[model samples]
Target: MLGISFFSVVSFLLVWELACRNGVVDPIFLPAPSQVLERAVRMFTEGTLLWHALASTRRVMVGFLVATMAAIPLGILMGTSQRTRAAFDPILSFLRPLPSMSWIPLSLLWFGITETQKYSIVFMGTFAPALLYVIDATRSIDPLLIRAARNLGANRWQVMREVIMPGSLPQIISGFKVILGLSWTCVISAELVAAKEGLGFLIMNGKEFFQTDTVVLGMVMISLTVLLTDIVSRVIEKRILKWQA
Candidate 1:
């Protein structure tokens, strides 16, 4: 499977190279693979590529951590209590559909074009969906287990800690893995502001100057970074859910 996938990508790039060389595609619009490779080498030598990757990584981690921390507890509470769910449902409804871009103007106004604003964009965009994922995960727990726990004199907190949290963890981790990817997307919008570094800024800057190679490079970097994070998340999930192993 890996060989096939590798060959498929190589074949595609080979065709793309031929297309560009034969003038079927404009280099100005779609640079050849060699051109992109040269550009990558240039960026790596300049050390900007690592900087952009690290900057984006930092933003993603901070924003994702904050969102997960807030969402898990609140979502579990909402799933376990009807009254809590009712109270928060309207607010979640209002915030859920609002894209990260929509929060830019207000975030900049409130946080003043700082890294905080960038992080805020990621947080705002990811928080609602993440909350929903956690809520559904918690809600999906076997009711009989919960009832049994309560019958054994487990209080609300104990029930949540001993029964609910354990049952929902696997799903929560899986959902947050996706949410982490969403945070990467939100960081792009966040960097649209006064940011100087980050994959998003790299792409936008390339766009401003018509440097499609840089744009493509930024996109590729983002994809690769998200893939690496996903792998790391899976490892962490395995360790945390070792009992399920």
Candidate 2:
């Protein structure tokens, strides 16, 4: 797998470089790999790249963490009890189809054009979907296990804490991984509106000046950051669900 990935990446770079050199594509729209790398090195040396990355990372973490924390309990409640599901279903139905872009107007109104507003945009974008993932995870647990726990004198809370939570954890973690990636997309959309410093801002700003290298750098940074976060999530998942497959 590592070999394939490495070779594929090298091949892609070669293709990209060749395309630009042969005039198969316009450099104005797509800069050469060397240009992107040069820009990346310059930004790194100047320290602006790290600052923008840090700002976006902080926003993603805050939004994703808050959204995940809120979703789990509500989702469990909805999954374990039909009454709660009935009450929340309509709202969920309405919110589920709405993309992250839809929240920009309301988020701007609620939190203004600040980092908090950006966080809110990501949070709202990810919340409903995360909740649904948790609910589905919880519902996938076996009813027989719940019955067995009950027969063994386990209280409702105890069953939930011991059985349901553990059984659903793997799925919940997996779902959060998906949501984390979604949060990046949300961040870009959010930044497109009012951000001054972030990968998304870098891309939009570059577009205004026709600097394709910066735009490519922004895209590459997002991919690298997402890959790093995915590694961290995988570590957490391994630790938390070590007993499971």
lDDT of each: 0.92, 0.94
Error of 1 at 161 (Å): 1.5
Q: For candidate 1, list the clashing residue pairs, or say none.
A: none
Question: How well does each candidate superpose onto the true structure, as a TM-score?
Answer: 0.97, 0.97
Give model 2's TM-score versus the native structure. Answer: 0.97
Estimate, for each residue in 169-205, the C-alpha lDDT of model 1 and write its tens digit.
Answer: 9999988988999999899878856699999899999
RMSD of each: 1.1, 1.1
Candidate 1 ranges beyond 4 A from true positions:
none
Question: Which candidate has the top score in lDDT?
Answer: 2
Candidate 1: lDDT of 86?
Answer: 99
Query: Candidate 1, which ten residues in sequence have the lowest lDDT sum?
Result: 188-197
lDDT of 1: 0.92
